[model samples]
Target chain A: MAMEAYQAQFAAHLPKAGPAWLADLRQAAAARFSAAGLPDRKVEEWRYTNLKPVQEQLFALDTAPVGDTPPALLQDSHRLVFSNGVLQGSADDLPDGVRLAGMAETMAENPGLLAGHMGKLAQGQELPLPALNQALSRDGYVLAIDPGISVSRPIEILFLSDGGASYPRNLILAGAGAQATVVEHYLGLGGGGYFINAVTEVEAAAGAKLQRYKIQQDASGSSHIATLAGQLQDGARLENFDLNLGGQLVRSEIHMALQGVGAEAALNGVYLLRGKQHCDNAIQMDHAVGATNSQQDYRGILDDHAHAVFQGKITVRPDAQGIEGHQLNKTLLLSDEAEIDSKPELQILADDVKCSHGATAGELDETGLFYLRSRGIPEDEARQLLMTAFISETLAKIDSDAVRGIMERLVGEWMAA
Target chain B: MLEIKGLHADVDGKEILKGIDLSIGEGEVHAIMGPNGSGKSTLSYVLSGRDGYDVTAGTITYRGRDLSELSIEERAAEGIFLGFQYPVELPGVSSTTFLKTALNAVRRQRGQDELDAVQFMKRLRVHTKALNISDDMLRRGVNVGFSGGEKKRNEILQMALLEPHFAVLDETDSGLDIDALKVVAEGVNALRGPKRSMLVITHYQRLLDYIVPDYVHVLAHGRIARSGGKELALELEEKGYGAFVSGTEAA
Candidate 1:
């Protein structure tokens, strides 16, 4: 079968093994990946987004390191390069009380902590890509913050794919009463066919706070699929935001569970697509305890023949009383051929919980357009203003200035083009 | 100061204003009273250059220039203002910011020096006080969550700030209470001078009490059928529009 070929190719390209547990995890993930294969239209979660483009391309399992990386792409932020899912260099200017090391080094130094939380956040997912990520992931960055410490600067993790299909798995664990912010960026080079299958897991202990930002800006003709899973303890807070501005066909999944009482979570995202690109965002939140709150807001702007899909769901357990949850997804279609499909759902078993979900898909308001035009603003400038305002409402929620500035610039450039 | 010769317009493919003619000189206030569906709104929209209201035939001359060739903003820059019946609600864009932008835009078009923040705020405070609008209204979004009466007063406040040479008030007094109406009319009357002209469009004679018109015209169907002095407004109010409607139908 085609899945066997991909698995064989992937196995041959993986880096040499470092330790027993790391090797065992890679093998198990590969086996699950081969058995499950790539999800198709029949899968309920991926019904709106088809993976045919990814399956049709022949991807090499190994990537050769770049001789000289392009300065234009890596000019803005501090670069953390990784090739073949292995960290190639170290980063400077790191904040105090924060540590970053390769996955192998962390596994050997802190086996108990890694074993307690790694791979536990994404257990029930049947997707082949996430399973493959867990099975074949190699050396990635590991960040650990001390208790009650807050870092002002954002820590950037750059995963680079030079060639072939690459899977970089990252694990982040925040200690009790600790606070920090991190940004995970994925980029590829050249027109050589590439695939980036990435997975990241975050854990926040009691009274801890974590802000995570993910940016997927890959090369043309490249395919990417990523999953971000998080677990929050009692009195902890987590804010997750994703900006998908690149990739020919990209699918992102975010799953969070408020496992402890008084915990809160916010999920915000924005996607800008043009040409023949396709992007999908799927989110799920579970309220397992009482007095927990969750909110999800996602917006998309599609042009040309591009397509976008948003699927969000909130589930409340029987004992999760006094829970407040809400979700909204709105899309703006710019071209006649552009398409957007949004699905929002809520399932509650507790009688004392409040939950609501809404989805809207429409074109620009003619009245609003005329009102702007009547004021002397050009048609193009008026459209740009409205689009910027729509996206800024979500971006303003970010707590970090540097991260929000980078996102605003990126979105502005995309909209201007 | 303003002239409309054989003005014809249509909305959604149906003709609304058919061959209408009117003219107003400087320092003159004219009131146009008409029954419902008499194309008063269509005339205002056409004059302001709002899209979707097709001006198929006719010529509108303002200050010796063809008004149809210019855009809404250009018309605004040329000192032609139209107070909308239903002002737009622009969330996240404060009323003060909107007014400042518009004021500077018009000023820039006229080759006038722009006002800085401090200078602009001073002028804005004076106008707000004259219109009896609190500073809180300017801080909030333009017309968002505003009551009907508040919206009308806001429109007048804008008129006061822009200081247009000629203005077309499109049913601005329809939803206002008596007190709000007097305030709006007072604001208008304060702006009246020898160099300015106004075209007040209304359905009833109540607004004419505060801002009395020098000339009164009755618009039936699409064209003006009768023109007289201010006493004509009282005559139309007492006799009702039945005479005008039946007279037109008979003709």
Candidate 2:
């Protein structure tokens, strides 16, 4: 399970079927990952989340077909099932101006399509996990929307982790004036110990808008680590929402580069964790141009010894002016043993900018509980009503009414169960 | 009917309510006037089964059942409602949700069918209109930014909606203006009937002027010092509680 052993073993088993450029790219990334091994507790980024639990697990990249065609989260949409990094079949439906293709099939059929795209965004990432993903990248999906074209149906990708370890590298390209919604759901089948290193890169052109929503419900013993790196152009917008419920350990990092004027980003998520589950949400919002705005709102509900970590940083560059970025994190500790550590950082080098950050962690309001109970509502129902009400504030921002209803129902089910 | 005999209660391990005996018929509206720290609020909380208002030596019988044997919500289901002086603010819960949930819960406890959304809204609209509560207020968070009189009116609205058999108004007129007090008192008056019993606790006579009580009791030093007709409230307002305090201590 040590890094050195896996490094050598992974290198020896590296597939030589790809082109020379891809091979070279993979080698360079592997070298970078080798130089800087997995971050430990001493590292500032990994301080709150202990990676020791994941490092102890041994994983092998063996593909075993589970043949899972699970029900779609949304009633009508495009669905794809990826089991152990292998796409089960081609994408469900196709509309004009939108292309959905698996990585392995695309590489085999049309190598030139991915020649200029793969490893382009992953190479620029700062985290070692992204580097590891680039080095061991396997089959995922690529969703490309044409310019000035808006898609009605959302693109849904169902990721099923059966056994062993897998690295899935995904990409989303939204052309100028394009608009779309993408959903990613990670689910584990059967109880087993595995590791998932996933990375998703998104590029939004000028005046484009894209919303990405994800739900992580892996098995209890699995460790799921994922990074979402997005770059926005002039007048572009990117909205990201994460609903983390399961998994023994989870680290979801959302990194955005606001490189153009009038670009905006909203990073919102919630972690409903219990039973020693640990989830860390790290966000890095870099405002490289003036007139760009961003906001981060995350809620945490920790119960039964669960621990959640939230670290958000908004940096306005020296020349950037008139940028407004704000972040707020609020947590409800339902049990005495539950814990939360929140750190909101604002590094403002710009002379004229508006940035504010705040965090709060507390238990349920006692007077509110008593008042509700005194009205004939049972004690448990009162708690559930209050907790769900607290979380629904952020989830209400979802643009689609159907998705919001589903999310609220899921949250209520979790509380009642 | 409700009965209390030798009721001794404590809050935070300190006895506040000494030996006391009181009785109320099903159709009577009684008022208790007292100075500060006279165990008035403690007695209301104890009757409603609030946590930490322990009854050390007492028997509170409501319809042949011991009040202490039930939980707070159980007491609510048994038709006991306490109108708080300061209504607790629920930041994310809307007034509509709170009212519907409370109504449905009480109905379920009473072995009756829960009202649907349409039925519940129709019932709530009747009370809100009489109390001058806006639809906007029902949509907003409960008591989040409500004015003082608005909060008191909201309590009265809830009392009418729940339709409790025994209602206790604890300092309901403390923060209301004269006009607001009239509105709230009218709302309370609407719900008064032959099957309902009311207990109004306050330190002023202005409220009793609007919703006149059948009987008035002056409390001092954790015991009822005097009992008389509704004229007792007017007398206490004129003379103040100095006489009642010194008289009870000397006795």
Candidate 3:
């Protein structure tokens, strides 16, 4: 009865009019999500992170105005704000060669693009949360850059959650030889206990360079489940950076398919959690074609009773020879009660491939602490310095100076807190 | 500036510094020379308030304050510096940041305002230049990937910046070559003044020739078996530490 009640509520909010194809896709996704339900600890991919607390919450669709964006998320760039799955805020002024449109507007104006690329990279079938997101999401953005054009500035997307539940789907497509940077920042407003299920799909054409940064800082009471899936063509480069610094129940899955030769993927992230927070980061990098390179680095700092999970899997297919795949997950448990489950998986079916995965979980280096304390730094300050440095490895991989500086400051503030 | 009486310490439940007594006045530089396993490092660790070096029985009074009553950083705030024999490498903390933090912490503890970035940089430049340390070294992590001589020099640079009243240089010349030893000794000599005292711990007299100590004490079997002027270091070097290492002294 509870499931039926929730399903009826979701059905009431479905898009009234859309293309027949999209409607069918949404219906199929809803069926898939309803049949599977929430993933439990028994799921192999989500064995370490439990989602019962999130599933038990009765989250209705939210259609209210989210408050002003945080100053930290407001940088000098083309900004898009999506509040409660509704496109709002400033996106009027556009660059000369960049195109930005809401998913609904894009589908209505140019249905051919959506018909060709929508749901191609991320099908929402690999996991239940993404499927649920696909069924419930009402509005998102469609960003596309023209061929051979380089957008000099970053395009910032701010996702603000007001209350209840919101499902947002974003699609980024860079044409051949086009270069651009995009930032997806998630922020929670008011007393947040809502569930945010978001999915972002990206496609990079040949010789295109795309950098996407995702920052998830939800309210302590909120639950955030997000999936980022991208495909790279020949000679295409993709750099994805995710920073998880909030949310009580959070699981972020990033999947990339290197579909063509010379395609490169660099997926990196840093998660800092304290209190009873639980954050899980899963990365799947597939070298489907030959001569591809992929690097995955994720780090976590857990304090108090916080728990962190990092599962990074790199798969090199039979035709993916001459591939170089590297994945490393390092975690620092600040408190004795803190926990970490780091699983680095390497599936290699190809010959002449170089693949390595390493996972390390440990406390603060004692020698480093003593070195700092002996120089008159107090114990707490010393620990903070060490932890900051540990997280800096991931921060340093960020390509943008402004974003890196902001992230560094946020890390410092979190440490002091 | 520093006095120790009946100082007994243990490492992992094994006694190291046994009934050691020593004293150093203002402007004094005391050198404790001994061979391996003579408790030279244990004594330095005990004096610097390093954890796990339990002071089972003793009192270390520095400027009339009981050193045992202070934490490691508290002792550092009280103007006690210990130059580690094996300087630690802090991988991600730059040497410049380390020096600035240490200086500002000590200054703040002494009721002084923290130095701004410019002020700290200006002050650090003075010490780094005087210690023959390069600017590039300051930008790298503290002692990380540094040569043995560079590690020793960095330690002296910290000593110069902190300007402690009583410094214990535990084998400052252990890993240094001839030129590095000379440069490090010059840094120490420059810091010598009426308000400051130092304890130079070494096994050979090679270092004493450079930064000449005011008083030389031979530490054998965890106790001072001999005490004299700096010449005692040369005598022990000539005779070797055989007598001292055997738990019997020819003092």
Candidate 4:
């Protein structure tokens, strides 16, 4: 089907009971997605990741699966489970100041909850994936935290798929001085073919802190595309860690704008790919104000015929002085056929600002391997140990020991498989 | 016991170890000292089955078995340990983790039960304390950002932990102060037993002074030019390696 046909089909499925404003917004977003169409190699940002695989398949909107509980991996989390783009049930074991609300239920109770902030942070729909998500998303959450309150518990959102296309949207707002940890788990059940378009918007007020963890372990026959956009206020901090270890094709585009002074953003990730999987991560960091800091550290382990791509862009405006930004992407290739393409870009228009970017792609270090082998470690075990050490360097930066442990264990299981 | 007959080796297609013959019996400590570019390190690498150090000729027999037939790790599992001159700095791999993995691997190959975390730690602490390796250093990455003395001590720590029957120390005293050298020598000395053997290769006789060898051989042009008792080390230290080099060239 053509782009317009898919948009028309998607528009036909828009819920008829929504308010007029939401219906109008959906129509506009549908038209925008149709106009933009699917991005191709000609698009510089999408050059390394071709969207032909997505274009070749036409999927209908999925119906909510019945009585699906949270996956075992998320049993301990205070979570809202979404099955096939429909909010199921929510549980709250969090602290007093934290609030987790399902968008569908919240919107039904109070129509004006999303009035000012629904599409405010994610205004730009120039990309087709985000535009498509905006047109068809029917289930997500509106998680908020009160000012001066710290929630020690983690808020998790599980998006489970059952072999069809689903669009999930999440909006997170942290009030002044509030802090919380959020985890987004995208999983595909039944080993079926599916397409997931996820869009998330985060707003951190002054002095607020937010740690976001995104884990993607979809089915091998699925395609996942997620768009993450956020803004930080003065003295705010954001730590976003992405773990990509599944799906046949995956692309995560992140855009973070530091609009306030003394704001900091740390974006780190690890991708373990094997078989014929392809994972691409594109990040854009905008330091629009002075005294803002940002760091991007991403590492990957690519094996077999898998391919990984990382393209990071950090821009400092002319007035944003005293900014410190560092971007790096390192990958370890485990097989002769595996491939990686990394590009770290830094654009600094302001003087007196420090910025650096680097990209390294290499095989295992021979000397390190020999050193381990000389101590009686077999070649295979020695190689795995060195590769794990390479990745542990980045995982060590994660402040939460529990989350880091889970991620490391997942990497270990992947290696063993 | 170890035996080498007409051993010839090359690195990067260039011959480094020419025809050489030597033998060491059980409980023997043999020292091979030579000047720079005399293939002291090459001989150690060949014995340990390192990659790219081609043995174009000759044979190395360990306990009546062909050492050349074993892979690097196989040779290590078979009780051949090489203490590197420059210990590899492995970031994110704690010293404790490395030692445990190495110990467990050798134990598994030898049909012995592997030690758990607590057992491994108890064994590690003994040697570490003897070598003056701090608890903080044991928790840190292996050889990462360690001082020169600390690196040498860590190598000896490995030697003590593994307790290989045939040990090869390649210039283990190259970058160490007097105090650190004494600690390292003490660690090596503690491991000496009737069933163990060692080949300590170095350029200077200073290390030999601390860990006296049963026999000392002067290696020149990839061949052992002279062999004698412990008194030969004192003789060479007084006259320097120039006498041996000239004598080997003249022969």
Candidate 5:
């Protein structure tokens, strides 16, 4: 069905008694999206990663109820299931002092609270995907942690998309002095082709801590574009790790703003590509205050005709004195046809700040390969070992043991394929 | 156990190891001493089947098989070991893991079951202690951040673990002090047995004093110019390669 037909069907299925505020926000967002349309290569930020596949493709929106959920993908994960766009199921073992539920429930219970935080951090501006998600999203989840609360187990949000186009939106609010870790997994089922356009807005209050792990392992024919925007207040810390292993075409845009003094942010990602798959990771960090620190590291391994793009920009405003930021992007091209384009930029306006950026793209070192081969290891085994080592640095940063194990297995399976 | 008959090799279109011949019987150790650019390193690389070295002429027979026809790993599995002159440092591969893999690979090639982790660790600890290599070095990446002497000792540790039928030590004593040289030489001497043969390549006779070769040969301009007993090494040490080369040219 065309996008217009899908939108009409979606509007008819929404709850009639839904809060008026949410209805108004949805309608306004739809108008904005229709006027702006999907992003194109003409946009500077989207220049390297074209969205033609996502825009041109038509998807049937998954509005039906989600049935039985599959077994937990990883043990020890707190499963929060979202069927179509509605939150349908949740695991019993949730961390203490944490409140998580479907978006509609949260909005109905606390209407003013939902109205205040939603769409505040991610305004879309020139980016159209976030706006599109905000307009078309039916229902999702909200995770909230009170002040001074610390959760030991990771909150797992599983977004299972049926064979239809789905827009999922999440709003995460970490109160002051609260600490939490969450893992958001996006997966697909059945042979139905679908597109997942998602936007997650994170707000870390003063002295709060938030660690997020986003795993994208959708099917080969699926298209996924996610925009994660984070705002860190004074004395707050945010660590985000993204592992993209499976997708036909994936573009992940992460934007962070250190709005308070003494705030710190760490962004790390690893993408393993094979066959004709294409994965792009674009990140931007804005240091708006003084005495802030930001560090970013992303590595990729490309095989066959796969292509990987990494574009990172670090902007140090004039008031952001005493800021220290570092960015590094490195890639290994396993085949002559595999392509990788890395662009790392540092724009500094403060003299007291120290900022550095580096980008490197090359094949595996012949000397290293020869050294391994001379040890009686076969060529394939040697390549596997080196590739594993190449991405181990990023994998080591995951604090959750169970999540790390799952990520490792996923990476191994992708490499073997 | 190993014989080289008129081995001629070239690296990058320039011929080295020109018409060299030598033979090593079981349990015997021979030292090849020469000046810089005398092809001491080239012989080691060619014997190990390293790339970029073209064996344009001659043949090498190991245990009555054509050794030159094998790949590097094949030769390694066949009990031929080459202690590199400048050991390559591989970051992120632990020394213990690397040695265990190589050891098991060779063993499997020889149709033997691999050693269990417990047994491998025990054996590695013993050899590492003998070579005076610290446990920390084994846990870290192979030879990465290791000092010159540490890298040389690690090479000896690998040599001790592999236990090849024939070993080639290329300048193992190049960047070592007196104490390090003694330790490495002791490691080599401890591996000496009736079934093993060694070809020690060096520029100085100091290493030979510890390993104590039964025969010594002078390699000049990629060919063996002179062959003699251990006394020849002493004569050359006293008179230098200048005298030998000039005398050979004059003759």
Candidate 6:
């Protein structure tokens, strides 16, 4: 009843009419969500995640303008802003071969682009969150890079929500041999009693290189749930990094399908949480073809009563022989009350495949602590140094120096806090 | 100047250093030699303020201040250095960064201006060269992938850079070849001065032969069984630790 109440309120924000196929897609998604409702602890994929707190809040749709437009992650980049749940004015200076537009606006002008990738990757109807996101998404962005074109600057989407709810359905389509970077940044506004359920679908065509970055800094009184479904063609590469620094309750699920030979996916993330925060990250790396690679490296630094969950699975199909997949999850527990639940599963149906998974959680190294403090470094500084060292292994994977520097500064701020 | 009066300490609630008394003035270097399990290393750990080496009953007065009142880093800030028997390997922490942080922290504690990067590197270069250490070694993680000799050399390099007034070398000569021994001994011999004092703890007389001390105290069980001049190490070396080890039965 609570979910239904919010769903009706969110539907009022969408236009009354769209194309027939798009309308049909929404109806089917709505039916699926109504049938499934909210997933409970019984759901195997969400065993470590609890939606009870989310169900009780019954967040409303507040249309008032909230929060300042945060500055661009980079000084020189294409920017898009979505206030509450609606897309604001567009970004300027786009390259000649790039098409970036809001989903609803794009449907009216050019439905052909949204026709192919709107719901192709995330076909699973069992997940209620994505189903609800598809049924209600109206103003998410659509970014398409033409074939053989390369965008020099990153495209940033700032989703600022306050006292309300927002459902953003995003699409990132990379043509053959195309390269671009897309950043989905979520910020909370006005003490943030908001709910954000976002779904992003990515299609990396043959030989395309796509880098996706998600920085979730939702407000302390909000719940941010997001899902990413990506499909890679031949020789395509996917590099994704997530920095989860804020939010009271957050869950990010990533499903990557390596459908093309020579395709690769490297998903790395770091969650630095404190207070009563709860963050869950689930990744399912599917190797559908042979000779593909996938790697998942995540680090969690939890203090106070924070709880973190990392569930990474590498599934190799029977035909996906000669594939290499590895995963590692390490956590640093800075407080006795802090907790972590880590499960790394590997289901390899193919022979001659190389796969490995590792998960470790513990406090800071005592010997290393003494080694630093014994030299005049204070206790807190020494702990911060070790925490930085622990996460540097994951941060080193970021190829962009500017992005890495900014992320490092944010990490420092979190440490100082 | 440092003084230890009626020193009693325990490791894991087991008494190790029992009612030991010793005193050293400025410009003095005292060598504590003993057989295995004589609490030689424990005394050094207690002096450095390492946790778990509890001082049950004693007074460690350094420059007329209680050493127990200060923490490990506080002791280091107050010019106390411990050259460990086995130096820890800290991966992912560069020697330059580690040393710079440490030097600045110590400087801040000592009411001295922090060294700028240029000044820090200049000082780092002087000590690395004096210790026969290469510049590349400082670029790598502190003691990471370092050989046994290199770890000890790094310890001495830290000692030289920190410039502690009272130093404790706990088995600093444990695992070095003759060539490395000479290089390390030369590094230690170079730091000797009338303003600095040292307490060298070793199981063998070979190290005492190099970093020659003004006083040699033979420890048996938990207390100092014998104290003599520099000739006492040679006498113990020739005769072995038979008399000292036997004296510990009643100690």
Better of 4 and 5 by TM-score: 4
TM-score of each: 0.92, 0.96, 0.95, 0.94, 0.92, 0.96
| Candidate 1 deviant stretches above 4 angstroms | A1-3, A56-61, A64-88, A93-96, A104-113, A160-164, A187-193, B112-116, B247-251
lDDT of each: 0.81, 0.87, 0.86, 0.87, 0.83, 0.88
Stretches of candidate 3 off by over 4 Å are A1-13, B245-251
Candidate 4's residue-wise lDDT over B25-143, tens digit each? Answer: 99999999888888999998899888999999999999999998899988888999999999999998888899999999999988899999999989988888788889889889999
> How many residue-pair clashes does candidate 1 contain?
2
- Docking model 4 quality class: high
Model 1: share of true interface contacts reproduced: 0.22
- The per-candidate TM-score of the B chain, in the order shown, comes to 0.96, 0.97, 0.96, 0.96, 0.96, 0.97
Please write out the lDDT profile of model 1 over residues A165-196, one tens digit for every residue.
Answer: 77777888887888877788776676545777
* Candidate 6 clash pair list: none
Residues A160-276 of candidate 2 have per-residue lDDT tens digits of 987788888898888998998888989888876788889998999999999899988888888999999889999999988898987889999988999899999999998999999
* Superior candidate under DockQ, 3 versus 5: 3
Candidate 3 lDDT over A81-142, as tens digits, reads 88877788447677676788787677777877777677776775567777777777777888
State each candidate's clash count: 2, 0, 0, 0, 0, 0
lDDT by residue for model 5 over B208-240, one digit each (tens)?
889999999999989998999899989988888
Best-to-worst order by lDDT is 6, 2, 4, 3, 5, 1
Task: Assign candidate 5 its CAPRI class.
Answer: medium
lDDT tens per residue, model 5, A13-43: 4444357877777676666666666667788
How well does candidate 3 match the true structure in TM-score terms?
A: 0.95
- In candidate 4, the residue pairs with backbone N, CA or C atoms under 3 Å apart (3 or more residues apart, or in different chains) clash, namely none
lDDT of 5 at B132: 88
- Best by lDDT, which number? 6
Each candidate's DockQ score against the native complex?
A: 0.40, 0.78, 0.69, 0.82, 0.54, 0.74
* Model 6 TM-score, all chains together: 0.96
Q: Largest TM-score belongs to which candidate? A: 2
Weakest ten-residue segment in model 2 chain B by summed lDDT: B242-251
Clashing pairs in 2: none
